[model samples]
Target: MNLRRRLAWLPLAAFLAGFLPATPSLAAEPGSENMLAHRAAYRLKLDSVRDNASIEQAEGIMLFEVIDACDAWASRQRFTLLVGDRDGNIVETTSDYATLEAKDGSSLRFSLTQMTGGAVTSRVAGEASVTPQGGRIRYQEPAATEDELPPGTILPMIHTIRSLAAARAGQRIFVAPLFDGTSADGAQDTTTIISGGWLAPQPNANFPLLSTLSSARMRIAFFERNTTGQGGGAATPDYEVSLRYYENGVADELKMDFGEFVVDGRLGELQTIPSPC
Candidate 1:
């Protein structure tokens, strides 16, 4: 993946919005107000670099907000990265993304815009729907494109719910294909998750909201789902993320791995919003 594509995924914080069951019923599906409406701010710090010698210093901020929209979940996220290279010059990359996911897990719509040096450099917008046969996407920006979603495809919110349910049931590993409209490449992602079961939140944790809910530590890896076997079996992931997830769907203590380097996102502020419902 190119640097732009790798950075594009950083603005996908909405996917981690809280999705825990309100009633503590294992069979219960998330409904209105089940997902906590909140905004979280994070400090983006360089974790490490392996192949990217151009980077000397890295810093930024990420802001993510999610709201309960009755029958759908609405979200907005932005991330800005300030990079100082060996040349003693700084470059700024900013990503802004918004999304809506139907509560039924049947549909998702997204818009993404990326800016470099204060100028719009790229845009991707699309809608995806799930059908009995499979899933499909229709793009409306940056030129039109259409593609079929691989079998057993899941959208972001549903994917989180599935993960939460699995954790609640004491399942250690889960795998599923997901399409979050982050890119126009039409590559579906297959995610594998190894999870530690639920535990009480620590008082010293950065996000106070976590203290009111059950939590788990999860290591998730993403791999491209290649149906035609064209993408060699040894194909590595585009990226991977490990984080602490709360029963209410909040994720913090994030470590994002982009093959060449790693970035850490630490929660700096968190505020719960009133649910309209």
Candidate 2:
């Protein structure tokens, strides 16, 4: 099963929180020209596992293009991911577009297109509530019938990136685990996610057109395992996610390491869009 399927069998609260920030500094306000330079295209390789055993693993190459960005909001960002399996075979792919609106808090609207077996099989749309400390996000797959998703569903990693961009420096944020209390068969699996931190700004490089940058390093722990049917004993797994953002608070790099599995991705490949006024 995929990441989303595994998480679907868990609990609803798993959607709560994820990611953090850094120490205080007189940095350029979020979304400055200095940070924009860091924005460019990159590739990723991910290893995924359960109970310390390899379940599914893939290497993904992605192109992230910045559509538009202003002091008030960033709009028109696009991402495409081509994923390959352990045997170096292309197994699945995803493409998505996002628009961010900055209010008292931030908000993001994004849609994902999933391709498998050389066909587009599913599309997902979701929104997230963004805050200075952390945020909450919820998504639904139109291909699925019920309002709630099943356990073990590895939802896309995009929401995690959105949450990090919304976080301010020196604040705590919680991301609900991937599993929302219901399984594919409608069973409840309880799990919790604890997260906290702030955005740390990085100095500008030789590139003058780029803006300053900031990053958040997060630690995640999964409590209470439900291994009743899998035959394996219950085990608590720990994970680490490191996120890097540019153009003030837009995501540019995302790295997730679950000890057993690791995913490293970068955003690039710019396309012009109507600038937010």
Candidate 3:
């Protein structure tokens, strides 16, 4: 049912002017030239569990890192989820997911490996290219599968840029196709609802990490694309995520809702990495 893939969602770091204009160091994207690089850790805890949710108790640690690779943005998310089943047994699952996207937003490469009870459960590797008409992905793990993305679609990193850009431009809502390699379902249509507004510097202990940055609240909903409009407006979303996105692309205060249950992740630690142009 691609359960593990569904668990692989996102959570970013970096400056206010980083998106204002493209500089040699700050090339206007997360992984561009001299963009913000940082490592962040979060503590995940169960929020609300529905009657159908098999998860009884969920607690884990999530570590995320973003590196600027000159022409590409390199990102990795290492998560360990401890799940308590109804049978009074606990299973520890770990997922290591990484991706590299070109700064020009033309291509993306992704790898995901999931281990349950210290055993590998799934591995998915793929690459996708964006074009004027749409995009295509070539998967290499589990089984080779090819999928198509519609026109006006955007990848993960580019989605971050565009969302932040929209917030800066006073735009409230945006709909786009996103391919994060988290699922075999290829590209999912996403609608981003943006709120909040730019604010002056804050008294954050993280200093440049959060104090000097502008921020906005964003809720992104994912849905299966409907080529046939027969479903009409009653279609429900597959999943939904809401977080605070920084001007520099870093996100925290994550709440992931899977309909039956909810998981909350709070930032525990954050460190900015020096960027080299």
Query: Which one is best on TM-score?
Result: 1
Candidate 3 whole-model C-alpha lDDT, 0 to 1: 0.73
What ordering of candidates by TM-score runs from best to worst? 1, 3, 2
Give the distance in Å from residue 111's predicted Cα in candidate 3 to where it truly belongs: 0.5
lDDT (10s digit) by residue, model 2, range 143-183: 33333322332222233433444454344544342322222
Model 3 lDDT tens row, 1-277: 2348656767332111122222122244443332467888989998988887777787888898887766667778888878786788888888888887767767777778888889888887777887768879899876798988777667787887878778778888977877787766687778888877554556676445687777888888888875653321126888888888777777768887867667798888888877664
The 10 consecutive residues of candidate 2 with the worst lDDT sum are 7-16
lDDT of each: 0.71, 0.38, 0.73
CA RMSD of all predictions: 5.1, 10.6, 5.6
- Write the number of the candidate with greater lDDT, choosing between 1 and 3: 3
Q: In candidate 1, what are the lDDT values of residues 69-127, reduced to their tens digit?
A: 66666788888988777799988889887777777767778778888889888888878
Worst 10 residues of 1 by lDDT: 19-28
* Selected candidate, larger TM-score, 1 vs 2: 1
Give the candidates in order of lDDT, highest first.
3, 1, 2
Off by over 4 Å in 3: 11-35, 51-54, 85-87, 206-208, 229-234
lDDT of 3 at 97: 84
